[model samples]
Every structure is written in C-alpha cells, then in structure tokens.
Target: MTDHHDRPHHDLIEHPRPRFAPWLVEPMLRNKGTYLKVALAAAMINIFGLITSLFTMTVYDRVVPNNAFSSLIALSIGLAIVVVFDFVLRVLRAYFTDLAGADIDHDIGGRVFRRLVAIRLDQKKGSTGALTGMMRELETLRDFFASATMTALVDVPFIVITLIFIAILGGAVVWVPLAAIPIVVGAGWLTRPALDRLSARAMSEGLTKQSVLVETVGALEMVKTSGASRLLGQRWTRANQQHSDSSTRQRLVSTIATTVAASANTLAYAGTVVVGVFLIADHQLTTGALVACSILSGRAVQPLATIAALLSRLSATRTAYKQIDAMMETGSEEPRGTALKPARFDGRIELRGVAFRYPGAAEKTFDGLDLVIPAGQRVALLGKVGSGKSTIARLILGLYQPQEGLVMIDGTDIRQYDPHAMRSLIGTALQESVLLSGSVRENITLGRPGVDDAEMLRVAELTGTHGFMGRIANGYDLVLADRGEGLSGGQRQSISLSRALAGRPQLLVFDEPTSAMDQTTEMQLIDRLQTELQGRTFVLITHRPALVRLVDRIIVVEAGKIVQDGPRDAVLQSLQRPRTAA
Candidate 1:
C-alpha cells in the first residue's frame, strides 16, 4: 500500500510553484533542521569515543603503576556514564537521520510522479520500461541519504580531531596514521572512474531488460501469435547477461578499493605499535600511551575504510540522480501563471497557418494548414490512412501543440487556458481504447466524485454498452483486468465511448470509435449519438461509411491539404462523380 503523504494532492499539480532548486535537493534542504540535529549528535558521539581511549591510558599509566584501586574504580565509573550517554546520542543520530530522509521521500517522490503526469507528451523520452526503471532509481538515491552511508560520511571530519589527539599523546607515532590517510583515500579515488563507467553500463542494460520484460508481458498474446517469443527471449537474455557482467565488474572494483582501505587501517595500527615500542625502549613513550595511540589510529582510519566500501553505492546513486533529474526537468503541460479556468468553452476550434511534425518524423504532417470548427458544427474528416485526418482531431484536442500556429478554443488561444480545464470540456476517445483495472462503473466515471449512477447508465445506454454489460454477472460493478482483459475489443470501445459521454462535454472528437463493433452495434451507436450530439461540436474521423449520418459537413483531406469542404450531400456527390484522366 502507498502512504497517503506520497500521493500528490490535485491542487499541487493544478497550481504549481516555481522551482528554486532541483526537485530532490529542495526537499532535503527543507529538512535541514533535522540534519543539523543529526550532525550535532555525531559530534558528541565522536567526542565520547575519546573517553574509552583516555580511560585505558589512565588505567595502565596511573592506576596500575601506582596500585591505586580506588582511582581505577572512579575512572571505570566515569567511563560507564560516558558510554551510556554516547549510546543515547548514537540512537538519536540514527533517528534524526531517518526522520529527515522520510520527509524528503514524502515530498520529492510525490512531486516527481506529479511531474511525470503533467509533462508534455512531446517532451516524453524513452520507452515505458526504461521510464519505470528510472523511477525505481529514486529508492537508490533515498537509501544513500538515509542509510549508514551518510553516517560514515559525517564521521570523516572527526578523523582530523582524532589525529590531533594522537599527535599530542603519542608524538612521532601520529605520522603513521596520517601517512596512511592519503593512501586509503587515493586507492578509493583511483577506482572511481571505472566504477562509474560500470555502474552506467549496468544501469543501461537493466533498463533494456526491463523494457523487454514489460513489452513481452504487455503483448504476450501478440508475441505468441506472431512467433516472436524466440526473438524477444534472445533480447532479454542478452540484456540480462550484459547487466550481470557489468555489475560483477563494478562490485569487484569496489571491493578492491575497500580491501585496500581495510589493509591500510591494519598497517597503520601495526606501524604505530612498532614505532611506539621503539619509543618505549628509548623511554620516550609509555606502554599506556602506546596502547592508546594504537586504538586511536584504528578509529581514525575506520571511517576512511567505510567510505571506500560505500563508493559503489555512491556511484550508483549518482547515475540514478542524473536520470531522475533529467526526467523532472522535462517541460510540463500546465500553463504558466494563473491561467484562465473558464467554466466552459463555446467549442469553437481553429488552426491558423499551423505547421507540425512528430518528434523524429521525416515529413511535416501539416504545413500552413488553416481550418475553423464552429460551435455545434458536426464535421466529418474524410481521408485515407496517413492523410492527417486523425491529426486534426489531436491538434484541436490540445494533445500536441503546433510549432508555427495557434489552436484556439472559443476564439482564445488554447495555450492561455489551463490544460486540464480546456481538456475537461473536450470528450476524447482515441483509436485505441484503454481501460484500467477497475469496476465498470469506476472506469466509466473515472473517479469523478460528482458523477452519479443516472449519468453513468444514460451514457452507457447511448453507447450501446448496456447491451453487453447486462449479461455480466456484476453489471456496472464488473471488475476489469489490466487493459480490460477478458473483454472483447468491441466491449472496450463501448466502455470508452460511455466514458466520453459521461462528462457531457461541450466537444466530442472520436477517431474510428466504432471500428471494433459489429454492424448492428455500430449502427445503433451512430443512431444514439446522432441525437445525443444535438448541441455539441462533433468531429469524427473514420473510414466507415455508415458513420456519415452523425455529421452535417464533410471535409476531405489529402497530403495534409483540405481537398474539399462543403455541405455533407454536395461533398458526397462530388466524391461519387467519375473522374477522367487528364
């Protein structure tokens, strides 16, 4: 189950504020107070760590040499008190760190998802599987900030203070751990480029594998019918193998760095002891000081080693951050500033000198195309495939913006109005109808709280949905599987058509809406819509001749140009006239 806080409220998307920082950075910065508290706890905890070393030194030098049991007991009691306080501080540090991370998670995760939904369709990049993989990277980023990795990072600065203490107490021996610091840091640094490269390769392969898996599952029936399993399976196998190899190499490099750091820590401790013993022989250092020096040397380099071990995680996090950041930076569909929220549009659509081509297309779908759709005008766009008939519907619906001209609703530029508000007034059912996993009523109403049972059934009856829905045991309550599984293509179209009418929209645009229905159902739907579309602006794009009954005007398009425009009967008569070769 998802947490309530992770869901972005509707108002957040409807009224977004200007972003000052990267989407993830702002949330972490917002919880700076908690991070500050965690920092303070870390400082106190590191300071308390010195107590153990000091106590050991005092026991060996003062208590043992002087045979003072009373002094030892007092030192032991003081050490116990410090230990208790230190434990509490460590626990508090962990709690504060987690609290800050949770706050960031709640804010940034929801905002990222919101951005994904609001981003312009033209700005979308990558396949569905790749996008999903990128989204999952959020968890890796959150874990980096919230886990023990951050704690290790915070402890690094304290290594300097530890070195200072060692220098003061075990003179000449402090140089040993200090010399090892550069070696440990350098080893980890040297492997970074390799680790980063491997991480990126692994991430890419993982995304590809995910894409193949999603595609296979989404179109399993088609894949089986078309004998594509062997091809897709080979692609999946290749991606998986490549990902595994890259991951293994990445881990190996990271392990080598960690192993070097660990070895340096041990060598630093041993080198300190070996040097301290010589000083002891020369009466320059005491046994107690030597022991204390060894303990402090280990503590100093331990953070460095932990940091080395975390290098791979850091690399992966960086890769994830770059991808997610790019996704969040895409252009959003929401208009800037306080956009007009008109209660309704008069349903007048116009495209003036419009030019457009899809992303990565070789030719323009429209060039200097000018057309106007009057309020309550029922028009049919007649064209063969690839003749830009459906493109006209999409442009009017504001699904895609023309590069060179304006799409106006009610004589006002569509860009000036809130996209949600403008689109709400236009009922759209595309060529491919998609139904989510939900009950029939839920799909019809689409979670609109204001829609009642009467409005739902009325639309269902008009769209001929009642004919098939009545046979289902659950009727309007029937639950659908993913993409309306277990239902025929015609049934899905009926449900989709019903949803379009459920809104009582001012404008209706459908492309091949009845392509999947039988002749009887198609005629019945056309009859019902002929009456239902009384005052609505209707734009129909279809190849079927029977649907002509719903429109009063006919416009024929060829190669992005309007070849003919007139009353329905005249256009039909012109089309039927025999043409002589010139």
Candidate 2:
C-alpha cells in the first residue's frame, strides 16, 4: 500500500488535446430545426411589432386629422389582425424554445452521468463535492437554454432591424438611440471582472462546504464516537459563511450592472423623445413619427437590459461548462484491450522481478519479488499488517498495474487480456464488505446474467447468509440500504461473501473475509468455503493462524520480501519456533 501523502498528485494516464463536449453540441444540432422555427417566429413577431408605430402614425396623421370615421374603422380592423398575428407568433416562439431546451437537457444530462460513472475510480478521488457541484451546474446550463437569456440573445439581433425601421421613421434623430447602445453594453461589460471574481469565490466555497458535509455524513458514526461533531459543524459553517458572502457580492455586482443598463435604456428613450420633438417642429418629422421613434428606441434597448439581468447565471454556467469539459477530456481508465472473448483463466498466477511503487511514493513497496501459485492450488498468504498481502491480491485482480516487471496469468501477460473479462472470471471478498442498495438477490447476483434462484440460494447458504435472509420479511427479496446500513457487520460480510461466490468464478481470493464473524461463525464459514472452493484456485490472505488449515501451502511475507514458503506443515512448524534476539 502507498502512503496517501506520497501518492502522485496527477492523473496516471495522460490525455491528448481537449475533447469536444458532444452533450453541448449534439443537443443544439438535434434541435436546430426547432430553433430555426423559433427564430422565424421571433422575426415575424418583431415585424408585427412595427404595426404599433404604423398604426399610431396613420391614426394621428391621416384618420384623426381628417376626421374620416370609415378610414378609422377599417384601419382599426387591420391593426387588430396584426396584433393577433403577433400574439400567436410570440406564443409559438416560446413553446418551441422551451421544447428545444428540454431536448438539450435530456441529451446532456444522460451523457454527463455516464461519463462520470465510466471514469476510473482513482481519478474520482476527492472530487465528490466538485462532481455534485458540476451536476448542479449542468442544470444551470439546461435552464439557461430555456431561460429569458436565450430570448434576449435572439432578440438582440432584431435591434438592428428595429434601428433600420426607426431610421425610416425619424431620420437623423435615430443616432440618439443608436449612441446609447454602447453605453448599455459597456455597463454590462464593466461588471464582468467583478462578476468573475465573486462567482469563482462563491463556487469554490460552495464546493468546500458540500465536501465537508458529505464527508461528515459518510462518517457520522466516527464523528460522534470521536466527539468531533462540533468541530465538523464549525468547519461546515465557516465554509457556508464564505459562500454566502461571495454570493451576496456577486448579486450586488449583477444588480448594479442591471440598474445601469436600465438607466441607459430610460435615458435613451427620453433622448429619442426630445430629439424627435425638435425634428417634428423643424417639419422634418410628423407628430406620429416622433411618438413612434420613442417606442422603437425602447424596443431596441430592452434586450440589453434583459441580458444584463442574466449576467450572473451566464457567469456561473460558463464556469461550470469549462469544468465539465475538463472532466470529460481527462483520460479514462485503461482500455479493456482487444481480447474480448478470452479463454477461461486456469488461475496459474506468476510475478517475476515485480517491483511496485504507488504513484508519488518515496520508496517501492517491494522490489524484485517473485512468486508463483500453480493452477488448482489452495495457498494462504500469512503476513503482518503493511506487509503487502492485500497488495498482492489487488495485483492478481489487475486493480493496480505494477511499476516494474510483468504480472502473468497462465503463460500470457495479464495486460494483454481484457480487464472486464478477466475480472468476471475472478471472485474477490475483501476485509471491508461493500454492499449497494438493492434486494438480497440483486446484490448477490450483481448483474451477472444467467444466475438464477438455485445458484443464488446455494451460495447464500454456503456463506450462511440464508440463515438471516429467512428471518427477514421478504427473504431473498429484502432490500438493503446503501453500504448495507441495516445489517450487522457479520451479516454484511456474509452477503459480500455470497456475492463473490454467486457467479461460480474460476478464481477465489479472500482477504480477511471472516474478520467480522464470531469464532463459531468463522469456523462454519471456513468449513463450507473450503469444500465449495475445492477444485478452484484459492488464495487466502489472513493474519489468523486458524485459517492456515484450509490451504495446502503457506507463504510468509515480511518487509516487502517472501521470508518463508513451504508445505502447510513446514510453515506451521517454522511459525511455532521461538524468534531469536536481534
């Protein structure tokens, strides 16, 4: 085992150039036709918007001035039709925009989850809180697509159309509203530095707080037993306070930008009105046209204010997008190799000149170590703690690659075999039992197809799990909480053992598998396991001498080297002898 502090601080696998996020791109492309519909609807809506000014111009300058009642009636009907068309277009755009957003949300959400699961377990270390935060950030992106921000972005281009129309209505005076565009835009831009600073701080503090909470909850028993609940609470509260403070600052900056944009819009509208009045007095514009210019100026500035209002969400979403992209681009676990359908392993394991040091370790765990366990042999690895007993088991399982030399299965390099296929043929039960949230049958079978009730019950009975399952109301259907929370330590271990044996694997590796059991229960389990594992290749890693009787051979490891290896009787005799003084 490697010391935690000395372990390498970077990914063991390197990646090429950053990979593109299909989640972000695919959704947009899939809904491109819908987006096009929305855009066309928006364009129609804006075109109809011009009807207001035109209606005003005609009513004031033509109908009202001439007192033509029939003209007024006819014009009012035309205006009503335009208003109805505009309303319908607005609703269609909103509906289609939301539909497109839903499609994007569904697409990206599934892909991100799958990616998170597929990444190597080593790569996920210390990232639980960040991953949780990233998941929420994904929601932010989904909501952004459906949000008014999208509408504002789409409407922004229509400002050009609005300006073009306004120019025709009120010629040179159009400059008043056009000049105000930069002022509103600059106001939004100026706050970005502040927004970025505060948002980053807030996100960092938020992840810290979440990490602490998850760690504390996961180890609640330890915290309570150790009397460190208050300390944990203080740590969480401090992180929360920092997050809240940063969030407050972020909101303040966003608000100021929004207010500045609104003020600019108001000023622009006022300027257009005053300037248009002068143009009308100079006989360069009609009375109705002056009024129309004010309306057009307001329409043009609205999108900028909306965008300013959405700045905070945009900033947060941008940060999240970058984080997700980086996570996806990071190298995944080693490939499963080309040996898709490997031959059944005979379980003849060998290691030659195998030197292994964990990443960033100051010294190797072992150097030039050689060992062989022939097919159909039952071997016990006896060693003191930290003597690499468990490391040997992991190496055999291909959980971690050796830094030097080769780990061979049968006569071939284990790396040449497909990892998934290799693992399927080996059964392992570790010192710490792990059980997921599922029914007893599901946990035992563990997604192994073709495992039926009789096989499940046989393994369960052999591991003594059937005894407890009979007591539960649902029997094999009884559901367990995550980590087997409702079961006693011994019961959990039994289920873990049952899971290992359920698939009838060719290789069985047990590391302190009976640690949680009482003496009587341990003896019973060993007897049953010994008979069950008779013809299979079995490796037992244990400190208890009682377990040595199950194996035909014994090996003792000390200080990163094999100190003793012999038939069971010879090793037992050597162990019984007194140690000499140093």
Candidate 3:
C-alpha cells in the first residue's frame, strides 16, 4: 500500500443552515377562524369594560347631580350584563388557546426532531448543547405565544373601539393613551440592551449547568472510581451561583423598567383627568363625556402597560434565540459520503492520503495515510498510542472522512454511497462496547431484527453470550441499563460481538475487542472469529502481537503512515530480525 506522509488539508463545500422555523408558524395559523372568533369574543368583553366606565362617570356626573332615580336602576342592569359577558369571553379564550397550544406543540416538536436528525454534520458541531435547550425553549414559547398572541390580537380592535368612543364624546382627547405609548416604549428601550446582556449570561450558565449535571450523572461510575465526584459537584455549584447572579441582575433591570412604567402611567392618567376636568369646568365638555374620556385613556394604556412588564422576559427569550442560532449555524467535519444502501459489498477496503482533525481541534489527529485490504482478507493493525490505527479503522467504517484523499470499498468512493447503506455493510465492536438500554435480545438484534428465539440462541452461543444470557431471569428479555452498567466488561464485549454477528455483516471491524477479556475468553473469541468469520473480511486493531499470527497479514502504522505491510509469515520473520522490528 502507498503511504502519504505530509501536509494538512481540510476543505469541502457545505450548505448553509436554514433561516426560518416554518414548522412552528404553519400550525399557529391552522385554525385561523377559531382564533379570530376568540379575538372577537375578547373584544366584546373589553368593549363592555369601556362602556361600563362611560356609564359610571355619566351616571355620577350627570344623573346623580340631576337627581335622576330611574338612571341608577338602569346602571345596575348594565353592570350585571358586563360582568356576565366578560366572564364568558375569558373562559372561551382559555379553552381555545389551550387547544391551539397543544396542537402546535406536537407538530413543532416533531419537526424540530426531524430537523435535528437531518442537521448536517457541520450544523451539529458548535456549542451544540443548545439543541437540547431548544426542546424546552420551544415548549415555553408555545405557552407564552398562546396567551400573549391572543391578548395582543384581541387588544387591537378593542383599543380602536375605545378610541372612537372617546373621539365622539371628547374630540382629540383620546391622544392621552397614544402619548403614553411612547413613554412606555422609551422606558423599555432604555433597558432592552442591558436585559439582553443579562439574559445571554443567564441562559449560557443555565445550559452549561444542565450539561454538567447530565454528564456527571451519566459518568457516575467513572467519577466515583477516579475520585472526581467532588470536582463535578464544585463545578455544578459554581454554575448555579453564576446563573443566580445573572438572573438577579436581570430582575434588577426589570424592576427599574417596571417602576419607570408605573410612574409614566400614573402621570399620564393624572394629566388626562386634569385636562378633562378643565374642559368640564369651562362648560366645553359635559361630566358624562369626561367619564367616557377617562375610560378610553385606560384602554389605550393597558397594552402598553402589559408590554412594559413583559419587556425583560421578551428580551431574555430573544437572547436565547441567539444561542439557538449558533447551534443551527455550527459546522462539523465534512463527510464525503451520503447515506447509502449497497446491495452487495465485497468488503475490499482502501485508504488514500487519509487525514483527520476533530471539530475545533488545533492540531490534526493523523495525516498522509494509505492502506488497502481485498475482500475476505483478515488484516491485523498494530501501532503505538496516537499512531492513527483506530482512526484508520473509523475511516474504513466511514464514520470519519479523510480530508486529504479518500476511503473506498471496491474502488468505489465511500462518499457516493448512502451513509446508512454503506455503514450496514460493516459490523463493528469497539474497545468500549456501547450496549444500549434494552434487553439482551434487543441489543443482539439491533442491526438486524426478525430473529426468533432459536436464531437468537444460535447467535448467543456463537459469540459466547449464550451462557450469561440464559442465566438472566427472562433470558433475552432482561432489560439492560444505559451502557449495560451492571454487566462486566467481558460480558458486555461478548454481547457486542453477538450484535456484530447478528447482522452477519460481510466486513467486521474489531477495535481491540479483547481489551477487557481474560486470556481464556480472548483465545476462545479468536477461535470463534477464525471459524465463524471465514470468507468474511476483518480489520482488527490490537496491541497484543500474540494475536497477530491469527490474521493472514499484518500492517504497522506510525504517525498516520503505514510503516510495514506483508503476509503473516513475512511480517513475523521481519519481527524476529536481530537488529530491526516490523
């Protein structure tokens, strides 16, 4: 095999992330008529509130002063009707808003997952924890939008009605509410940038803490064994404190904004009444009209007032969107291949100038590598640590793309094949057996299903997992914890071996599978591999030279380049040389 030994190259074209979240917007508009009806109902209720104020001021200012007894009795019935109408509208809005929220949540959540799954590798590589946060943020968004949107929608027509009523009763007098709007907006504007800063800090720290907590729990065993539990706890505590500090600062900004808003509303309300009273005293306006003008002022200020209170919250969520946008825009190591499904893979693997550098890595993992193995060939790869042996294995498995050149099967570029289809051709059992959270049978039959008890038993015995599997209470039905926490390393590896063979793949890639096995178990596995894997190609990366004799050939890699390659006998003879080693 030819070897490449120099230079670094990492360039491949990529598509940009999407800018819109259509999945969410589409569903919100699905029941437009219902939402409109709800808005109309709410408008009616708000109109009643405006009318009530008009009637109250008109009654006291005109009827009471005039000693009109019958006007008071008519006022009671008007007030009663307003109460009943408002109550009914409130209930209807609640029911419809809840129904809408639930439907949007389901549709958007599913689309979010689909988007997440289809996210290009480059898009998944940055401060990627935000994807998890997006799940929660989107749900919270649905809740907020459901309430805020309906109210905001309802306020538009309701607000216009009050303005018109005031104009007819007191010309140009309704401007009081409009005047207060700028003040409310100005107050929020002053605090928006500051709140954004605090919000960014708060969200970052909160997500970091969540990630740390999840990692600590997931690696509880390793943490305990390494005496690093205290380290994780300290980090978690510090994260919590930082989050608290950010939130407190945010609250302080909000408090100031809210105080300023209240002051503005108070001054505006006082000014409106003062203006109305002056007009009344001059006999230019009636007391009844003054009352109606006051009602209109209240209606205009309501939306602005509510907006002032929600200012901090809205800024924080927008800041959160910044983080989310980063995740959606992140780039990852570009793979040459698409998801593939090949009908027949002869299992001839090849590498050409293969090189790799992990995401955000300052230095490359390996470079200038080349190797090849024909179909049905068993090749043992041996090397020192950091020698690019495992990297080569992964390259062959199509998990990592080579930046410099290419990895191929049967001289066909791996990138041209569908990712899943290509991967289906190879079965892998790494040093760390990633046993999923499921029953033994489920784990064994992961890559390929449709296995009956008899077939499962056959695979179990073949991979030396039958004895332990049978010992479990429910045999293949015994549920395993995440990563098979309760199982010994040997047991886990055996089950993983079964999983590899379950699909009966043509190409088996074993990355030091015997790392945790005892000598007897290792020897047995080697024998089984030799017998059962006959006619199947295998790439075994291992440190033990003892097993090098089991394969038909040996390849020694160093510094991402192949140093030695030959037939088993030839490599062994070279190793025995007095002054040199293969």
Candidate 4:
C-alpha cells in the first residue's frame, strides 16, 4: 500500500533542471549494438569452458579406466587453454564497456555545462550547487552503469541458453529444477517498487548533502557573524545522517534482492541433486551426463544471484540519466545572436514609449517612457529605489526587452544588433562589481585584446588607481583575490574604471561609480573621465548631487514614471527645494 505522506515527498523532489541530454545520444547510439555482440561472444567462450569441465565426466563414466598418460596430458592442456581464453574474454569485455561508459559521462557533463549557461537567472537561481553536483559528482556513478556494467542483461540470458543445452542433452526431466530461475525473478519483481523508491531517495539525499555543504562554505562569514556556527554544524550532521539513512534503505532493498536470488540458487541446486539421485537408481542417468549437468547448473547460480543486485544499480543510473536529460532539455533564456565586431565610434540612442514588467512580478517597472540622446551627449539618471533606474540600465544593455515600444541605436532597433556586439560599444563601471581572480593586467583590458602596456598604465593613472596600485607589493602584477575580497571598495571601483576605459568604448556608463570614493578622489576621477571621454556618451546614475556639473541633462523618475526632465540646472533647482522621506 502507498503511504500518502511519502507519496507527495517523492513526487515533489525535482531533477536539477530539465533538458534533453543531446550530448550523450550520439555515443550511446554508437555503443548500443555492441552489447549484443558481447553477449554472443561471451556465451561461446563459456560454452567452451563448460565442455572442458564436462570432459572429466568421460573418465568417471567409462567402465575401464581410460587415463592414458598422453590423453591425460592433452586433456589437462585443453582445460588450461579454455580457462585462459575465458579470462581474456572477461577482461576485454570490461575494458570496452568502461570506455563506452566514460564517453557517455563526458557527453552528459558537456551538455549540463552548456545548458546551465543558457538557462535564465530566475529559473536556475536556487540550484547552483545542485547543478554542479549533477554535472560532476552525481553523474560519475551513472558512468559505471552507462558503460553496461549490467553484464547480467547479457550474462543471464547466456546462462539460460546454457541450461537449454544441458536440458536437451540430458532428459526433459532435468529441466524441472531450472524452474527455480523464475521464482528468483518473481521475488525480484515484487521488490522493484520499493527498490525504485530507495534508489531515487539515495540520489536525492546525496545531492542534498552536497548542496548544504557548498551553501555553508559560501556563507561561512554569515554563519560566524550571526553566531550560528553550532546550528550549521548540527545541520551538516543531520544532512549526512539523512543521506546515510536513505542509502541504508537502498542497501536494504539490495540485500533482500540478493538473498532471495541466493535462496533460489540453493533450492535449484538441491532439487537437481534429489532428482539425479532418483534417476541414478532407475538407471536412467549416466554418471557423465549427471556430472556435466551438476557442473553447468552450479556454475549458473552465481550469475543469477547477482542479477538482482545489478538490476537495482541499473535503476539508480536511470534516475541520474533522467536528471541529466532534464537539464539538457531546458529552454534557453535568450536566443544567441550572430557575433558583431566594431570598427569605429559613434554613440546615439532613442527610446520611444518603452515600458516593461519583470516576469512573475506584480507590477510594471516602467510606463510609456520616452527619451533620446544624440551622439556624445552626457545624461544623468536620478531616481529613488524601485523607480526603475536599474531596470532602465538593463533595458539599454539588452538584458531585457521592453513590452511597449522600441529602443534604437544609430537609427536602428537595438534588438536587431548583436547583444555581444553592444557590450563592446559600451564601457561600464558598475556599483556592485566583481573582479576575477588574476593579475591586475589580466583584470583590466578584460574587454579588448591587444591592449598595450602603455595604455594600461594610462587608464590606471586616469582613474586615480595608479597611486595605490603602485604602492602594492608587485604593482600591477599583484593578483586580486577571488571577487577582489582583499581590495577596498574604492580601489575596486578605480580598477573597474581602468578595465572599462581600456575598451575605448563609444559610450560610457557609471552606475554609482564614484559612490565609494572620497570627495577629493571623486572630483579627480570625474575630471579625468570628462577629459578622456570627451566625445563619448555617458549615463551617470549617482546620489551625489555635487557631481551634477559633469552631465548636460537630468531626468528624475518616481513610481515608474518620469516626474521631472530638463537641463541639469533646472532639475537641480527643483530637487534642492526638499521633501519628506517615504
């Protein structure tokens, strides 16, 4: 009977992300037919080994002892040859199977990484670590099975075929004992539902533990500051314990399956012996035939016993395959654009009644907004929080498309231009920016190749970063920490300016770029930007009203609509009058 509570628990747990595993399909299809050939070859190899063993029965069956020296020597050599060939066949099969399996894993990981890159930030926001686990560690287990480690699918049938050979040579009565095979198979079938559940739970708990550890490590500072170290430790312990419990349930099913098969083996062997003893009394069975049947039957039991265990493992691999498939099949957030490269600089932009709402959000962020900037014009964006300031920046960057109207650049709709191409046209120093782990030189000039050494030093000097960076141990060669954690906020911003300016873009955007710097540094940085970026357009989003002198125009937005728009002087006089806090 199904437990209703457990039913929903299993039903609710999802695979990392859904996509078809297209990468795995080609190699899998190539290796798909190899198993058939392997099975046939193995059966022939085993049959020879069986014939070698059966030859011993001829000695026992003969009335006069027929153990001549030459015959004994030849028989010994033949048996040795058969044993050696059997070992070689087994080893070769394992090697080829493992190779096939590794290829499948490679394909799965490749597809996982590629699909993850295309998934939208919102859809994949919650499963970073789980996605990593699915691509890397979890799929390793699946590799073993994809390689066809379920040799039983082939091996079991071979054993069945061997039984047919013996049953035909001997009497039809001998096959009565072989009926135990179905009994073992039946018991295994009964355990399938439980086994499937156990296997899926095993995978889920393992991935959960992996996700928790990764999350904990990422938030170690938060855990320390919040005094939740003990709580996190307990959570870690509990996760591992749950994983153990789930794995044990899987093992429990495996144990039952193995035991049932083993018991059936014993029953079949006993039945064969009992029937043979009676047949011997009736003079219906020869010692040679009886011995041959016993040997073949005994040899067959080992594989049948292992079948249940192999099937259980195969079930687990199937679960992992589905997870991999789900990620590969997911829809992409943006269609890839044909890459466009630039030859020169010209900056112009126009927005006509453009408006947008974020997916799943309750309200729109913009309503019929209209604006235009001629070549090389400097514009300032002023807005309170949630007034669609950041969203406007995203829309200009083509991170999101507007719902109502068009955004054009140089008289053409921006969407028709390549997204990657637009990134090169704009040089941006962001408020909450990240510096990748590498030398200072590598961090700067990140946008453009063929950056001259002189140009790097010039950009750094222009941004006021040269003063501090020169004092560091190795100057510009000093490697930043991951995310630039070792650097101060102001220093990071300066470096960001150097990196952005290195591109020599037609348009410059500073999203609160000077917010971290002191008044003296901010003044110098803004002056340098004004001089070096003389012909470039600018979108300066800042809280410092003192810096308003650098821009030609100002627009203030409130509640997703433009409250004010005019020359910088006019807007400033209006804003200076003052108002109460929200």
The candidate that achieves the highest TM-score relative to the unseen native structure: 1
Give one digit per residue, the lDDT tens place, for model 1 in 458-532: 999999888889887889999899999899999999999999888698888989999999999898888888889
**Which candidate do you rate higher for lDDT, 3 or 4?**
3
By summed lDDT, the worst window of 10 consecutive residues in model 3 runs over 4-13
lDDT, candidate 2, residue 446? 83
- Candidate 2, residue 222: lDDT: 91
- Cα-based lDDT for every prediction: 0.86, 0.81, 0.73, 0.72
Better of 1 and 4 by TM-score: 1
lDDT of 1: 0.86
Task: Write down the worst ten-residue block by lDDT for model 4.
Answer: 3-12
Residue 178 of model 2, lDDT score: 89
Model 1 sits at a Cα RMSD from the real structure of 6.0
Clashing pairs in 1: none
**Candidate 1's TM-score:** 0.92
TM agreement with the true structure for every prediction: 0.92, 0.89, 0.81, 0.81
Cα lDDT of model 3 by residue, 16-112, tens digit: 2355345545887786766877777777777777778777777868678888878877887878888887898888888887777777778766765
Q: For model 2, what is the error of residue 353's alpha carbon versus the real structure, in angstroms, after optimal superposition?
A: 3.6
User: Candidate 2 — what's its lDDT?
Assistant: 0.81
Number of the candidate with higher lDDT, 2 or 3: 2
Runs off by more than 4 Å, candidate 3: 1-92, 95-104, 111-136, 153-161, 171-175, 262-292, 332-340, 359-366, 446-455, 545-550, 576-582
Separately for all candidates shown, the number of backbone clashes (residues 3 or more apart, or on different chains) is: 0, 1, 11, 9
Instruction: Please report, as a residue range, the 10-residue window in candidate 2 with the lowest summed lDDT.
Output: 7-16
